[model samples]
Target chain A: MPRYKITFAYDGTKFAGFQIQPHQRTIEQTLKTVVNRMAKDPDPAIPVIGSGRTDAGVHALNQVAHFDFPFDIPERSMVRALNSQLPLDIVVKKAEIVPKTFHARYNAHKKRYRYRVKQGEFVDPFRRNYTAHYKYPVDIAKMQQAAQDLVGTHDFTSFVASGSQAKSNVRTIYEAKVYHDEALDEIVFEFVGNGFLYNQVRIMVALLLEIGNGQRPLNDVKRVIAAKDRQQARMTAPASGLYLVDVSYDE
Target chain B: MPRYKITFAYDGTKFAGFQIQPHQRTIEQTLKTVVNRMAKDPDPAIPVIGSGRTDAGVHALNQVAHFDFPFDIPERSMVRALNSQLPLDIVVKKAEIVPKTFHARYNAHKKRYRYRVKQGEFVDPFRRNYTAHYKYPVDIAKMQQAAQDLVGTHDFTSFVASGSQAKSNVRTIYEAKVYHDEALDEIVFEFVGNGFLYNQVRIMVALLLEIGNGQRPLNDVKRVIAAKDRQQARMTAPASGLYLVDVSYDE
Candidate 1:
């Protein structure tokens, strides 16, 4: 058997989510179906392990996954074959042979996420599916200054949604930043961290947006993290604006 | 009755073009349905006259149209009401009361169109609906030079599709230009002209793409226009990448 590491991207607009569900269209199930057909083994379906699961309507630029094949094939050929069979919404960008011990989920050391919010009174018809729309005015400078507090290790219980079953809430954020894209008239929020709690990025975005809109003080992030209460951050940005930009692992 | 001119935009991905059809959903039909409902008249449905009809899968940035209302309403109110009632894919941007003699189709003096082509070996899933995918290598300079020949009055019979009902094939192109958008990795072609016959822009784009790919010489545009035969230029670009950018009228 040969194990392969693959990098892929998906639109996520039409997918239920990245995880498998009964009678639901998901990225994992779609990949499994194609890989199983290629493996020519229905007895034990091929399994694809992703670095992490993205919520519904969340896009990915370079999602990493690992799967084992019953037979060996050229890496380039594998990429072409999978892309040809998969739907247009999903594209396998790269495939490479990897050691059997390598795991997509366990070996991942860092991940980066991006959230895009369009600033305008009316939703742009073309970008409705890709960007979250913000009607109120916002100060990008205030959001940028507030995001610095998200760095370093912190207990993220204040940001995690209630459905999460994680044993611990401590996480290290390597970098967090905010910038305004003038060309598209959009505010972009990026977070790079060792790990993130469920809905952590979205919650932070919501709080930052509030602060930028003057509903909260510029230093609200510090107070919210210290409180460690989910009620401190009530809003979570819409999933349509979120993207799993990249994932990292040691060679 | 108050006649008004409205500027709107739409994501044409799900529309069956700008013209009304018997059973298919179209931009014109959708607008009529909403406006008629607002007008509270079913016996005589309100009519919408667009500047021109766009082919299926073609987008528009500022498509202009005119309609008459049974009663008077403020311009701002009309815009807000139509936007609220129309689907998320269509948005009314501006509305203004115009003279009763104004015609959206005949009042236009100049029109601008844009065609976007993504340059890559593999199709980008995110841009599949918004851009045409071109796999072969292209030279922007060659395309730019070839496009210059199109910036003048000429008989465009070779570029017009077979179904055109225009009395003459003569049209004047005020400007034709091509530029590479590095950030998006797309080659954008723009045309400003007094009028274009059916499928003229698409056909010209196909010929320019061929010239850029080294299949045709830089002077192919001149030769093709001189031929005055439809078979001289056979290829027409896909509609997904075309956009009716703007329409101009004399005050």
Candidate 2:
């Protein structure tokens, strides 16, 4: 059986999340059902592996996944056919054959997540859902200065929720930066990391926002990381404004 | 009774149009229902008058309208209250008391409509409804030349569908211009006219698109105006691409 790597995009408003559950609608289960139904050789079902799970109401501009098929299907045809069956909010962007050893989750080298923030007196009606609206002015210089503390390897247990039971919380953040687009009145934070713990990105964003608003000191990020306590990181940003932007791998 | 002028915006996907009907959903009907339910001094119902009727699936950025109220309501409070009752897709941007004789439809000096076209091989999923996808390279210079001829006063009977029973087809076009946003892969046509006939904006957009694609000659706009036959203007563009951008009036 040949493995296929698929890149997809979804609006995230209509889905529960990228994982399967008993009664809730999910992207992973929806994709698997569509792929199996459309396959030339129908099966009980095909297991679909995702690079990572995105929370409900969290959109994905580019999400990578992999699945095996009993029969051969052209890459372009697979994309076109799957998109026809999937809901309009979810679209299969690209599909291609991959090596048997290639794994969507295990073989991933790096991932990039983007958080959008709209800081102004009023939120643009059209982009209200896509951006986390902050009704006050954000200090860009303070945000940039605070972001520097998170741009290194550290145990990020403080950023993750208490429910997570990971053996280790060590992760390396390659780049942590914020870019403001004046035309759109939006501030986008880009984070590229070797790996992220559960709710890591949202929690980091919450701290950054606090620092930007002058509520928290600029060095709070470093203190939170060093404390290694979940109670220290109090806020977790909403899922609606986070997007899994890109995934990279070693060839 | 004091008349209130309202400037509003709507996404228009779920709405049938701006008018009330037997069973279908509409922006005007929705507004009236909300206002009736929220009024401290409720009556039979308030009639909401729109500056012009937008076709089904057409959006609006700044559509102006008016209605009568028995009691005084602050402009800011009215906007906030109406918005709370309206759906997320529709928003009342402004609400203010106007002259008793200010009729939304008849007192207008000019109306501005915008048509968006995206010329690209692939339609972006995010903006599929907002822009009409034209899968070809458009000649900007040709579109400009054709637009020049479309400006100024002319009898536009050729552009109106047979269903319209207007007294005269003559209308003055104050300005007609096409702006290309290369970064967004969109071509926006802006028209400020004294009035437009039924289906006039869509038909003009279709003709402009044909001219931009080099299918029609630069003089086709002039020839079609002289023909005065609906058959001369063969195409009418989709309503999803049109927007009621502005409605101007004398102070």
Candidate 3:
């Protein structure tokens, strides 16, 4: 068997998520179906593991995954064939043969995610499906201060959603930053972390948004993390604005 | 009656075009519907004239139009309210009261358009609906050279599609440039013209693509234009990648 790592991108607007669930349309299932058909394997049973699970309506700009095949297929040909069969909203960008030990999920070294919010009276119609529309005013400087408070190792129990079943909530966030793009009328929140609790990014964004909107003080984010209770965090922002931008792995 | 000039954006995927037909969904019809309802007149006859007609499946980033209303409505407020009632894909970005002499179609000084093509094995799933996928290798320098040859005044009969009803084929093209973005794996074809004949831009793109693909020489574009026959052009590029980027007017 040969293992190949594939890099892809998706809109995630109409997809349930990256993982395939029974009877639901997902990016994983769509990719697997096309790959199976192309390989002409009756029992495709190809197991594809993504770098991380993205929630419904979340996008990915450079998502990496790996799968094994029974026979050899040209990487470039596989990319073209898969794209021909997949829906317009999903694309397989690059494929390369990797060592047998390569695992997209477990071997990942770091992950970067981006959340985009439009701050204006008018939303861009072309980008409305991809960016969250925050019509209310926000203080960019205050939000940047709040974002700084989230960069460090912490037990993110407060940031995790209530339904998350992870055994431990400890994760190391290397960096968290917020900036404004005046030309595009957008606010961008970027996070690079070793790992994240479920809904951690969204929760952090909600807290920063509260601070930006004057509902909470800039130091409230630190207080919430120290509290270690889910109730202490602000609401989770919508998933539409979130994007799993990149995943890195050691060679 | 008060005349207003409105700047708008639309997805154009679901619209037949900019003009209203007997039984087709159009940008004009959608805007007229909203205006008629807001007027509260049983037979409100609000007519909207767009700066230019864009084909179905083409998009617009900054489209201008004009309409007349009998009653006074705050320009900004009307834009917000109209956007609230309109579909998510169409947005009124700005609205302002203009002099009665202002005409969206007739007063326009120039227009700019962009055609996007993805020239890689893997197409971004999110942008598939908005970009044309070209898997073959493209010579960007050759494409740029060919595009440069298309600038300035020319009788573009060779670039017009067959069955076009335009009375004149002479049009002034101010600029045509093609460039590739390596990070995005995309090529953007931008054009600025005083006016375009029917299917002129699409035909130009098709010819440039041939040049890029090595099917034709760079100077072949000049010969094609001199031929002044619709059949001299290569092929009509798909409409998905075409966008009406901007329409300018003199103050």
Candidate 4:
């Protein structure tokens, strides 16, 4: 048996989520099914783990995952083999043999997310799946101010979706910023954090955009974090705008 | 009645072609259906004409067309109205009223075509619909040389498809070049010509790719053109890689 680490990208518009659910398509289940098909003697219970789960319609630019299969395959050949069998929307960007010690989810140290918003009079249809359409004008300074107020270690209970039940709500956001690309008329919000609760990033993005739109005050982010109530941050941005960009290890 | 000139873009993956055909969906038919529904007194026989027809699966970034409608509508509003009704794959980029004498097909002086090829070990799934995968090493210099040889005024009977019934095959290619975008790992072939015969751009691109692949000699383009035989240039590139980029007028 050998463990293989795979880095991949998926459009995510059509997927249910990254985790397997009954009668639904997911990245984890898809990988297990594919790897089993490639095996000489298929194993239905092969284990495949991802760094974390992404909600439905949330994209992944470079998601990290690992699977253990009972075969000896070269790295380069594995990339070509898996890609040839996978669908067009989900692609394995790279594959390599990793030490057995590496666990995709348990060993992860940090994750980075990118949220994209198109702020223009007309939305390019080509970008509809990848970016959230925010037709209203935005003030970048206000967004940056809200982002600054949210950075640092804090109990992000209000930012998390209501159903999430982690042991602790404390998380450290190493960096957070909003940038506007004039050429594309897009606003990109990137956040690097040790970990995120379910739907935390989208909620934060929605609130920041509201502040930018003058619908909410810039200090609302700080108040929400201190309040520790999910109902305080009501807006949850669409999954289409969020992307899990990278996963990092302590090494 | 008013004549309007419209510039549009389309993904083209689902469209049969730009022209209406029996038992098939097309850009023209889609546009007519949309405009007819928009009209106060619906005219089912509205006239819609494109600058030129694009083959099935061929995309467009700046395709020009004109239509005559029974009602009057402002250009900006028309753009928004048509877009709201049209499918995501087919988008009307701009719309404005034109003189009755302005004909999209007849008044066009030049048309530009762009073909993209992905040459690498693995094709990025994200680019599958937009590019043709060649999966081989290409000689950029060789492709450039062939592009230069194919440029200028010539009897391009060899490049046209066999079923074309044009009176003359002579056309001038104002510019032809092959460029490599290192970041995208793609080769782009751009051709600016007065006009092209049926399937001329695809055929030219096919032969140019063959030359780049070292399967054909640099002088083969000239020999095939002088021979004035479609059989001399057999390969017709797939429609997925082709794009109608621009249309120009003498006015």
Best by TM-score: 1
Candidate 3 is graded, for docking, as: medium
Candidates 2 and 3 compared by TM-score, better number: 2
**For candidate 3, lDDT tens digit of each residue in B1-251?**
78889999899878898888889999988998888788775454878889989988899999999988878889988798889889988999889999999999999989999999986556556677688878788898899988888898999999987767889888888988899765555799999999888778888988889899998887988999899887888698888899999999997
Residues B1-251, model 1: lDDT tens digits: 89999999998999999999999989999999988998996676789999999989999999999999987999999999998889989999999999988999999989999999997657888888888888899899999999999999999999999899999999999999999887677899999999999999999999999999999988999999999999988899999899999999998
Candidate numbers sorted by lDDT from highest down = 1, 4, 3, 2
Every candidate's lDDT: 0.93, 0.86, 0.86, 0.88
**Can you tell me which runs of candidate 4 are displaced by over 4 Å?**
A162-167, A181-185, B41-43, B162-168, B182-185
Q: TM-scores across all candidates?
A: 0.96, 0.90, 0.89, 0.91
Question: Model 1, A101-176: lDDT tens per residue?
Answer: 9999999999999999997667899888888989999999999999999999999999999999899999999999
Per-residue lDDT, model 1, residue B128, is 84
**What is candidate 3's lDDT per residue for A59-148, written digit by digit as tens?**
999999998877788898877777778887877788998999999999998999999998767667777778888888889988988888
Encode model 4's per-residue lDDT on A14-104: one tens digit a residue.
8998999999998888887888888854645677799999999999989999988788999989988998988878888888899999899
Candidate 3 chain A: worst-modelled 10 consecutive residues by lDDT? A35-44
**Residue A153's lDDT in candidate 2:** 92
Worst lDDT run of 10 residues, candidate 1 chain B, spans B119-128
Residue pairs with backbone overlap in model 3: A89-B125
Interface RMSD, per-candidate values to 1 decimal: 1.3, 2.7, 2.8, 2.6
Please give the TM-score for the first chain of candidate 4.
0.96
| lDDT tens readout by residue for model 2, A3-56 | 899998887867899999889899999898887887654655788999988888
